[model samples]
Structure formats: structure tokens, C-alpha cells
Target: MKTVADIILHNGNIQTQDGFHPMARAVAVSGKRILSVGSDRDILGLASSHTQVIDLDNRLVLPGFIDTHFHFYEWALNYDSIDFSRVGSFKEMENAVSNKALALGEGNWVLGQGFNESDWPENKIPDRYDLDRIAPNNPVCIWRCDLHLSVANSLGLKLAKIGFETPDPEDGVIAKDTSGRPTGVLKELASNLIRNVLPKPSRAAVLENMQKAVGDAHKFGLTSIHDIRLMGGLDGADALKAWQQLHRENRLHIRCHVALPGEMTDQAIDLGLCTGFGDDLLKIGYLKFFSDGGMGARTGWMTKKYLDAEFGMPLTPVADIERAVLKADQVGLSVMVHAVGDRANKEIIAMFQRIESHDRTRCIIPHRIEHVQMILPEDLEKLSTLKNIAVSCQPNNLSLDISMIDSCAGPRGKYAYALKNILKTGVPLMLSSDAPVADPNPLAGIYSAVTRKRMNKTPEKGWYVEQALSVEEAVKGYTITPAVASGTGDCLGSISKGKIADIIVLDQDIFKIDPDGIADTKVDITLFDGRIVHER
Candidate 1:
């Protein structure tokens, strides 16, 4: 008698994202592994009366998404915080803050995030005075969308102790008016002062919040992610503990590859940890390093000055990065460094070249660069020819940064987000949303990559249309490429025999839809570990 399969998904347009079995009409799952993938007739032969069979009704099925770069742990906790993303005008922002403050009442901290004042019609960053007028009794701290800058109300500033004469810390800026009074805008490491003053969430709270995020991720077809750190490299230990507890309790449904801040590289080394240290469900990923601030905050450390601003600044000196890379790589710790500007990218590339020359086999996983958002064409050869280096780009950011890049990068914008060129260079370019920074929707990423246009589809011809990727290539960014980057290529990322049974069925065939329609596509069913986790 043939063995009965646990579940059989048949009559579907399954795009396996595997080179061997690129397409299939049905797939059989036994336990947590794929039993077989083939035509409906061949797969049905393995199913018995006890098996749960599903007919996809011609829907599109593919491997579950893996976000190469995500701060979803932190984004999950921000549910209680105010969300000011896409606020059109200053009046709207104030109104939103006023409502939240009223809800929280007096003396309570009113926390918020995702305020991009640059996109507002007024084109002005709100000062402490603007927040004080509306929420005088409550302490308010709202972070910019980029997470590199924040604005605090007077009460919040007082709590953080910024009453002028406080020297700007190295690698940080405390924005102030001419009279030397802090305007309540804190940039880079300066935001840490206010963060230190704010009440911290307990570990239990973090785990609870992460459970909610897991449930939410299922609905969006995300089965795995690389949990990255927040700015300034704080709380890596605490965050790891939270994830460890969640995994031990068997409450963690998503596969997590957690990256530790480079500051903790020594601790990781002492603990005998290296890349891919844990089991399939949880693993130690990379030693994450931030080389520069974000472009959204005009602190991306560009090669040339912005249209009106100073040459952007480097958040971490090259010496610190080089030392960490050398030490970590010697102990088999792969590095995932964030580089968003041409200068940062160029500098990091040089550092990687030096390391590659010295020791090529130390790290188990070769170094990767996160958000290769900008690179001069002249320097493309470094990233492309280097077989060991990988690149992770977030097209979702392109949707939010089209205007910002144009304004800030000016004519040099040609070199910004040159994803297609990166792909041609033989570099493994994985797609990620960056979550809280941009919506962590893989479909939205595909839309942006295929269109090179913002949400509104401005610039009728598309922004640098030449760089747009085909549907197949864009889809690969979220699937096969990321799977290879995370070192799960053999077991995940496709519907193939012996691979993990992680799949999602979409309401629309993304390849058949118009470029604009990609963002509107929805998931109808999601299966993780051979079980139906989401259905709509």
C-alpha cells in the first residue's frame, strides 16, 4: 500500500522557484517535509482517504517569503506606539499626536514612530514647541520614519536632560536653534539619551508582542526572517533572550535567523557561537554592523554633498568596522554590514577587499552588505566580481525613497538603487522590506522592483526605468536568492521533494497581472511546516 500523505495541494499554478522543478501542478506533504512535487496525477497517487486535499482553483502558489533584512521584533512592539507614517501635513501630524496624548492622559509617556516630516506639504520638521502646544501635560517622543532621528516634546526633553550646553556626542547631532536651545530633534546616537530615559518594556512584554507579530506575519506569507537590530546596536542580548524564551515555549511559529550587533561579537565568540549555530527553527545569523545612517535623515555618508546639506556623515568609523570584521571573521562569524550611501558602500567595499586578501576561509558564511542602496558605477566591479560577498536590497524602500533620493542625491541619483546592474554582476541580490522602515510586504517589493515607481506611480515613464526587474527576477529576490543567502537553499525556498513544506497561495497570478496590480495581490492560503496556518 502507498503511504498516505498528510496533505495534498493540487490543481494549482505552483511556481516552485527551484531550477530543477521550476513549476508544478501539485505537491504532497508528509510530516514537515515535502513528499513529492509533480503533476496532479502523480501527487494524488500518494494521497489516501485520510489525507486533507486542497484544490487551489488555479491560484498562484510559491515558496513562503524570507525577509533577508527585518526589524520585525521591534516593529511588532510598536503596535501600542503612535504610527505617523504618510501623514500629509503638519496639521495632520499634530492632530494625530493630540488624539493619542488625550487617550493616554497626563504624566504618561506618549511614544510614537514613523513620522517623515520630509514628505509633508509644509516640508518642515516639527519642533518641540509644536508638540508642547498640543500635549503639554504628557511627555511625547516621536521618531522619524528612518529611526535615525526623533522629536521630543518639552517635557520629554526635560526628562532626557537636554537644556543646551550639552555637547553633541561623537557621531551624533542634537539639532538646535541659533540661540543654542535644543529644538528637541535628536539625530543618530543623540536619540539614545531620550531612549535611555523612556521606560523599557519587559522581556515578557517583548515575547508577548512577538507572538502577535508571528500571527500577523502568517497573514502576509512570511515564514522566515533575519531579525536585525534597532539603531545604535542596543538590546541584542535582551532581544535574543526573548526569542530564546519564545522558541523554548514552542510559541515561535516563524523561523528566525537573529543577527547580533558587532558590539557583542566578543560575547558571541566567547559563547562558542558562529553563523548557523542553532537548529532549523532558530539560528545565529551574522555580526551586524552599521556603517552609516539612513538617507531619509540625510546622514547616509555620501561621496558628494546633498543638494543643500553637508557631506553626509559616517555613523561608524572605518577603523572600527575593519577591526570587527577581521576579529569576527577569524572566529567564523559572518558580517552583515549596513551601507546606504556611495561613500559608505565604497569604504566598506575597500575594507572587505582587505579582509578577503588576508583570510578567505575564516567565516562560515561570507560577508554580506545590507541595503546597497547607492554605489557609484565605477565601484560596481568590487561588489560584482567578489564571489564571496552578497547583497541585500529593499525595493520597498525605493517606493518610499523615490522623491527623497531625487531631492537628496540630485544628479547622482542615477547611481541610487541600481538593482538590475547589481544582479548582472553575479552578486546574489536578496530582496527584503526592512519592515518598520517600509511595509514588509513581499508583493509591494515586487511592484516597486518591477515599476521603479512610488505608490502613486509618479514619473509616468518610471524612475530609472532601465533598472526595473522582470517579474521572474523580482520574485527571485524574495524567494530563491534569500533562501541561498540564509543558507537554507537545500531545505527551503521551493516546493521540491525533501524540502520543507512552506508554501503560500496567492489570489492572483502575479506574473499575469499588470505591474501596478502586483501591490494589490493578496494571499489566500499559507502553509507552514505542512499545516494550514492562514486561510482567507
Candidate 2:
């Protein structure tokens, strides 16, 4: 009996991202997986008259992108929020919020995200007073691009119970004015004061947004993501429930490895759930915990003081985090801790060293550090030496942090986003968008990794030029590296026989194009689980 392919893509340049078969001209898909991949002639032989054949026209074809770290659920639910991702000035941010408030009418909460005052001409973060001046009637709260800082209007502050007399939460700060009144600018945990009070999006709203988000992601050629539960993670159990329900209904097209919070280790263990449990469409991932805050908020746990500021702070100190790691490891759940500063990474590495000392590869899955962004030159090798530890770095964050790294980190910024050195050690370097914090598009991330430059390609020579990675290396970070991290290496990540049929065809061959053009790259067509989901 001859096996027939359900669909076939031929006449194109295909980068397999697989070491075994580095390139191919055609690929055939049957059901939910790749049936064959070879030259056009070879693949065409496997296709029957019923096969849906797509001609690539000498374009670029690659495995769909996989974002290793993402706040996908939250990003989706907040889809209608005013996006400040590219707003250039504080005044512009205010105008955007005012417009949203007017559009939504008065009395309703006007939620928005992605405002970076650091990139503005004035270089000053917006304050509550500014938001009040623009949207006095509607309560407004907008997040900084980093998501670690937020500014709220007077009405928003009142709703969240934040006032002049309110003290900052532990491991967080409330910016105050000269007269010692609360400025309505909250950092880290302080921002949660507002988030906790805001009305949660209904279950229907979340599911709808999830579908819309995946549809939009397909346009960017994204096939998979690790949906990180943070900023009120697990949403008191609603988040995971929604994901599982979607999977059950066969409504989810994007592969997801939904991560839980570290504190939920007890609940996970109680349910006898281990990391990597569940079907391919949805799986349980590592337990996520914040070892420190973002550098943009000046709360990253750095050893030395930031320029003109005090030393950074860690949200969960070493001792506390170690306890959580040990508990999770004992229950067979892998850990993923966010560590951006040198001190934070060092502390996490030390904890893992101790955990592995008790048993080699203690957890079923390898432990990982998210955003191992800023590190000392001497400490660079420590992360790679841990065989079971992976580093998930967001190169796109580098584009946003290039100027901030230099201005705030001073001379210590030399080793920021050390991609070249990290790859040299042969440790798994997973690339991601950390979406809503940055563009979820993996091409933007790949461009930043390959060029080490901002969106406009400023600085001509690129920032930290020595830390740049090649185009292939960057693709692996977004593809195979994340696939392997999710325990899908055997089935996903590459356009090879037996792999899941998640593929994307590009309008242009990114390999032959200029480094800057990588960001402008667009997906011409996308196929997921052998089904055509997008074509542009």
C-alpha cells in the first residue's frame, strides 16, 4: 500500500533546522505530522491526486517559530488595551490613553500597556497626575513596556486603595513626590495593587482572545509558545482551565506548554501532575518563579549599585527561592526562574548546583533561567557548566534595553545579553518575545539577535557587537531550542519526516537578505497540524 500525503509544499528553499537534514526543497504532511521531506521530485512522488500542493515559488520555508517564554494568556486577554509599544513620548502616551478612554466612554476602566518613558525624548516616566490630567473621569492604568512599572490615574489609585498614606508592598516601591505624596507610579509588586482590584476578564473573553491571539501569531509564523503564568499567575486556576478546555474542544491550533507558578508546586504534586504532562496541544511546563525584577525598574538583583542609584533588589531572595526549588524538584517538577541581573543569575546557578549535587538531573526535565540577560564576564561560564540548566534569553529585549543598559548599567553593561558567549558553551539558548513586554514576533527577536541593533538599525555598528549571533543560530533559539525545551524535539521544530507538520513559508529568503530586513520579513503561508491556517 502506498502512503499518500494530505498536503505537499514544493519548489522552495527549506531550512530544516535539523542537524541531520539541513536543507530540503519539499515537504509532505499527512494528518498531524510530516510524511516526507526531500527534493521536490522525491516529495512529489509521495503525493496522491487528493494532496493539496502548495508551490513556494523559490521563497523561504522554515519550521514555524516557537517562543520559549511568553505571557500569552494575559497578552491575549488584554488585547483591547491601548498598545503603547511604539509610542515615542510621554505626551504621546497620554494622548493614546485619552483616546482609548474616549473611545470606551467614561466610567469604564481604561487599561493599556507598553509605554517606555526611557525611550522618550524627555526620558521621564509618566506619573499618575499626568494620567489624571488626560482621563480624569475614567480610571486609567498603563504599564511600561517592561511590565515591571505602571502609572495610574487618581481614580485608578483610589480604586486600588493606593493613597498618600499607603506604604509600598514588600519588594516593590511607590514613587513619591517632593511633598511625600504617592505619585501613582508603582514598581514591581506595587503594581499588583491595581491589578488585584481590576475586574478580571470573563472566561468567554479570555477564550475568544486566545483564539484571536493565535490567529494573529500565525501571521508572524509562530507555531508554539510557553505560556508563562506571571503577574497574577494561574489567574486563581482560571488560566489553566481555559487552556485545557480549549484543547479538549480541539479549538487550539497553536501548541502550548503552559507553565504554572512555583508556589503551585503543592497543588500540582497533589494532583500527581508532572512537567510535560498532557497532550501535544497542551502540556504542563516548569514551575515559574521570579528570582528578581526587571532591570528597567532598577529592581534586578545586581551586585553593584546602578548608575546614580542604590544596589538592585531581588523579589524572592536566595534562601526563599532555594526552598521552593527544592520542594518542586522533590515533587518531580522542573523550575524556571527569571533572573536578569548578575547577582540574580549567580544566586540561581548556585541553587541549581546544590540541587544537582544531591542527584544528577534531579528533576525529570532540565531547570532553566529566564532572561539570563545581564551577567558579569567572569560569571558567564557558570550557567553553561550546569548540564541540566538552560538559559532563555529574549534578544528583542536587548533592542529595548540597548540605551538603558549603557545609561543605567554603566561599565558593567559589557556583558549584557551575552548571546555569542552563551552559544559557545553549547548550553541551550532558547529565544522568546516575552510578549506584551515586547513584540511577540520571533523575526524581530531574530533580527535583534543577529544585528544587536534597535528597530531602526541605529548605532550602525550594533550594540555589544561581539555578542551578536548568526542568522542560523538565532533561528535555532526560536525554533529547535524551544522545541527541545518543551520535550517536543522528536516531533516538532524542524521540517523533517515524522515531525509535527507546523510549517511557515516566507515571502523572501531571509538568509540572502540584509540583516535589517529580517524584521521586515513576513509569512506568506502557514500550515499547522497539516491544516492550512493562514495565507497572505
Candidate 3:
């Protein structure tokens, strides 16, 4: 006889993205899998005398949220670092760094994330002298909100040996003053100059951070996340190794779809790691490539010059990115390129057009152009063609990029977050908070998609109200679309029978709430594999 396992959730409005059951009252779980879902009485009848039954008390239950893109490692390491998440003035930032340095003592590295020059009134990137004046002996590194840029103090530059003679790396830039001296700021590849010199964290530290990040994800009601960047350099692949350790220990609570950086695309291909190389806990989803830099960093490849500036270059040239995409497709590995500008998206689409198969597995499996921010009107159609190409959009960008749009895009800023336009073209859409840059709050992200308003709540309606999505469409992007993007749509997207028992019970009916209030809603309970992981 088959031994029955424990637990079942009954009496709730289960919104299974599966459509068949728009609302289910109960669900049965055996061990880690969902055994059945139906009426309250039907599911409760499956419970053995030993089964644990949970009454949801009419709270709305749905598939656990899945973040299609995020940097889990970075988020974890930042917990101990200085937080500039809310610091407004440069004085405030300096004070924060000084305080952190005092706490850590002299000579300690004072690091922080979420410092956006655009957010400052002066719209200027701070330099080494600013920190050198505060913490003269400490090495301080403050990452720009986009993570594509970092401003280090004089001490940090000295610690990393970054001097005037330091030639710019092929793909990165070290900002220089008008006098051609190092300006204590680095962009993109240039960031590695300091990171490479810094001592790598211990394996124990990596594990600890990984656990903390995972726990945080669970509390946010995320049962799955696609670790966006997993590239390792001279450190001997610590990121991959740490993830494997977490998987082996069964400590990785949520499903993880990891990406191998473009630098290691060859290695991933040689190892025969396709889209689904591992079990539920870990899998090789795609090979990530950078076609252009990020938006806030002003490095995103643009066809025409930026409205305010004449200088901007693609991280990878048009020819090179296309060639890499074609080669990755030929090798049976899916490709995902970060293309934020209209030109970058067009160039990536042109490259994807070369892929010649309808087979999702062999040809071009769900190739993604991450952050299709300023997509061209004409090129939107290309998304529907090309066998496996989806737009992995970051809708929360509207909240963060509002100031940038006014300063950078000037008149063309209207197209910043075009969710409605993108979706209407019949392209599959997935939503994510590029965290540490934006809050990983799915509700906030969803609210942004539907409303397109920033923190100040301007625009009355939205930047491009015609492109705004419906509440249901936006929610589907967070739940169903992400699962589909990760190749787990059948098992994880919805609250359905025989699916993974990962679900979230929200405090209010998401659909019934005011559109603007959606972001304010709370997660009452989060469950993973039928086990309660977080409860308010």
C-alpha cells in the first residue's frame, strides 16, 4: 500500500492560472507535491487521519510568485553593507558610509548598494574625495542603483591599485577627470578592477548569505527565482558551487532556474547543460549575455544618441551579439540578452531572426531580450515571430526610471514601460524586480505595470496609458508567465492538481482591491511544498 503523506489546505479561493478552476476551495498535498485540487469536501476527503488540515479562512490563495530575474548573491552580501536605499542628499550618503566605517573600524571595506546619481538633486555621480574626507582610512564602494557603476573612495582606489596608468578593460570604463586622472568611479567591466583585487568571501560566508537571501525570497511569497547572473572568474566558480551545495543540502527551498553568464556559455554547452539540466530545485535555464549596459548607468546601447548626451555604446557590438546568439542556438542552449534600448532590441531581434526552427527545444528556446525598455513601434511585431523569444520585462522600472526619463529620454520618455503594447503583439511576457535596484515587491511591480506611476504618483493615469495592462494580465506575468519562462508552467504556475504545493495566501483579494492599493497589499502566509515557510 502507498503510504500517505501529510497536510491539505481547505476553504479558500484558489486562483489557479490553469483557467479550468478559476476558483478552487481546497487542495491536497502528499509530501512535497500537490495531490489534488477541487471542492472543499472533495479534497478534505483525501486526508488520512494523520493528515494536517489548514483552513485558509477565505483568504485568496494562488500560485507562489516566481521572480524570473534577480541577483540573489548580490542581495545577500549587501545585508551587512551600508544601505543607501533611502539616503537623499550626498551629505546623508557620506554620513551613512562614515557610520558604517566607524562600526567596522579602520581599514575595513565599507560597501553599500542603491546610490543613484539621478536621484540626487545635482544629478551627479559622487567620487572618491567625497568619501576620503569622511572615512580617510576606510575603503568605501558605493554601487549605483543599476549595479553597472560604482564610485569608490581614494582609499578603495589605492587598495585596488587603480591609478592613472590603469588602461580601460575592453568592455569597461574607468571614469577620468578633465585632467585625465582616475576619478574614483568605475562603470560596467571597470567594476571588476576593485572586485578582482578584493578578497573573495569565504565559502561559509557565501553559504550564509545564500541562506539569508533564500529565506527572504520565501517571505516574499516567491517559490521560484531565476538567479540572473552566475559567472565566476579567477575565484574558481564559487557562485555555481554554492548553489550546488545549497541544492545538495536540500536547503534551497524554492525552485531555482540559474543562468550561465555569456563568458561561460562555452563551458555550459560543453557540459551539456540545457534548459532543464537539473531537478526541481536547480536547473540551467538559459545562457545570459549583455547586449548593452543598463538604463540608469546610461550605458544601454542606443541606436540614436541619447536625448541629453551624444555618447553611448553597446556593450557587445551588433555583429558580435548576433553571432553569439546564433552559435548558442546552434549548440541547443537558449539565449537571453540584456537589451534595454530600442536599437538593442531591434538588433537582438535581427539576430534571433536567423534562428530557423519551430522546435522550442532545438532551435531557439525562449530566447529573452531582458528589459525591453524603449522598444520601437515597428519592431514589436518581431517578438511574435522567431520561434522562442519572450520579453522578460521589468515593469517596476517606471517607478525607478521616472526621473531618468525626464532627464535622459526628454521627449521620447513616453515609451519607458510599454507593457500593453508589448503584450498586444502576442509576445509572452514575464515580470521581475531587478532587486537591489528596485524593490522585489511583485505587488509594486504589478502596480507599476497597470498604473505606470512613480513614487510621487504623477501622470494621473500612466506614462503611456494606452500601453497599460489589466490587473489580470499583470498578475499573470508575475505568476504564470514566469513559470512558463522557467519551463515549469505545468507544475508551478497555478494552483492545480499534481502541481508543486507552493502557494501564497494574501491578506486581501488582489482583484477586489483598488488598483493603486494593490502594491500596499500584504502576504499573509507563504507556503512551499505544503510547508508553511512564512506567516504574518
Off by over 4 Å in 2: 232-236, 360-362
Error of 2 at 123 (Å): 0.8
- Which residue pairs of candidate 3 clash? none
Candidate lDDT (C-alpha), each? 0.86, 0.86, 0.78
- Tens digits of per-residue lDDT for model 1 on 332-403? 889899999999999988888887887555765768999989998877988765757889999988877877
- Quote the positional error of residue 191 for candidate 1 in Å: 0.9
Ranking by TM-score: 1, 2, 3
lDDT ranking, best first: 1, 2, 3
With candidate 2 superimposed using the best TM-score fit, by how many Å does residue 29's alpha carbon deviate from the native?
0.9
**For residues 97-137, what per-residue lDDT tens digits would candidate 2 score against the true structure?**
88998999999999988877777888998788788899999
Look at candidate 2 and give me any clashing residue pairs.
none
TM-score for each candidate, following the candidate numbering:
0.98, 0.97, 0.95
User: Alpha-carbon error at 501 in model 2, in Å?
Assistant: 0.5
Cα RMSDs, all models: 1.4, 1.4, 2.2
